[model samples]
Target: MLVLLAAVALTAGSVSAQTAPTQDRVLRQGQKGQGRMNMTPEQRADLQAQRLTKQLGLSADQATQVKSIALAEAQEMQSMRSNVMAGTDRRAAMQSMKATRDKYDTQLKAVLTPDQLTKYTQLREQQQERRQDGMENGKMKMKVKS
Candidate 1:
């Protein structure tokens, strides 16, 4: 029974991890820029709690539960990302990310209603597109400067 619960938590945790982005270090052109690594876990947790509470209009209990879920997910995702980054298997790393994402979506459906879930999906997609566009713009600027 304990093992079953652990397995369920692990599965849920992995899914949460995909939605939560733990800030990581990015190195480009031999210059390393640390992004979002200065904050400790507690700090990240607090901020995330605040954000989710505001965004989702979560009750106190819901906020606490979601924060706990997000933290576990973030830790697992961070570990997986680190492992993939340290090795040469980029394809495997991508597969891991996809699996994690799928798990996250599944868990979300269980937690949120169809309406809330739809809003959540839209928000996630917008965030992703914004991040991608920002990165692309940065690269373009770099090329122009060079």
Candidate 2:
């Protein structure tokens, strides 16, 4: 009887040990330079122009010109990135991006009329401010969690 009881107790103990609750920890990390293809430059420019038109009350002609400039910039940037991005090289990628942006800005300035350019510049500044605000908010959320 004693041996039988010992065997049952040992079996139960082993079963419980095997089935004990374990916490699952999942660590999510952001992917570098992912999903750029999903967002086409035409779509980006259209969205930007739409926002600006609604917010700044731009004329139809100005909006159309801006969209064209944006599309051209997007195509040029794509070409630049294709030529430059190789291996795991990040600095080269950044330099190419900067060059493309500078050229795009020059093209945009040339394409837009003076009044339109003024509004466009203001819109660009607002976009930058919005992006900065979003980053700050994200950081605050992370800090709150930690």
**Model 2 Cα shift for residue 88 (angstroms):** 6.2
Clashing pairs in 1: 15-104
The whole-model lDDT of each prediction reads: 0.65, 0.68
What digit string (tens of lDDT, one per residue) describes model 1 on residues 42-80? 555555666656666777876776677666656666777
For each candidate, give its TM-score against the true structure.
0.58, 0.52
Among these predictions, the greatest TM-score belongs to 1
lDDT by residue for model 2 over 1-146, one digit each (tens)?
99999999999999997786532111011111233354577765775566556656667986887788778877777776676654546687778788878886887677566776788788779878977897888842443553
Q: Which residue runs does candidate 2 get wrong by more than 4 Å? A: 1-37, 80-88, 133-146
lDDT of 1 at 110: 67
Lowest summed lDDT across 10 adjacent residues in model 2 is found at 24-33
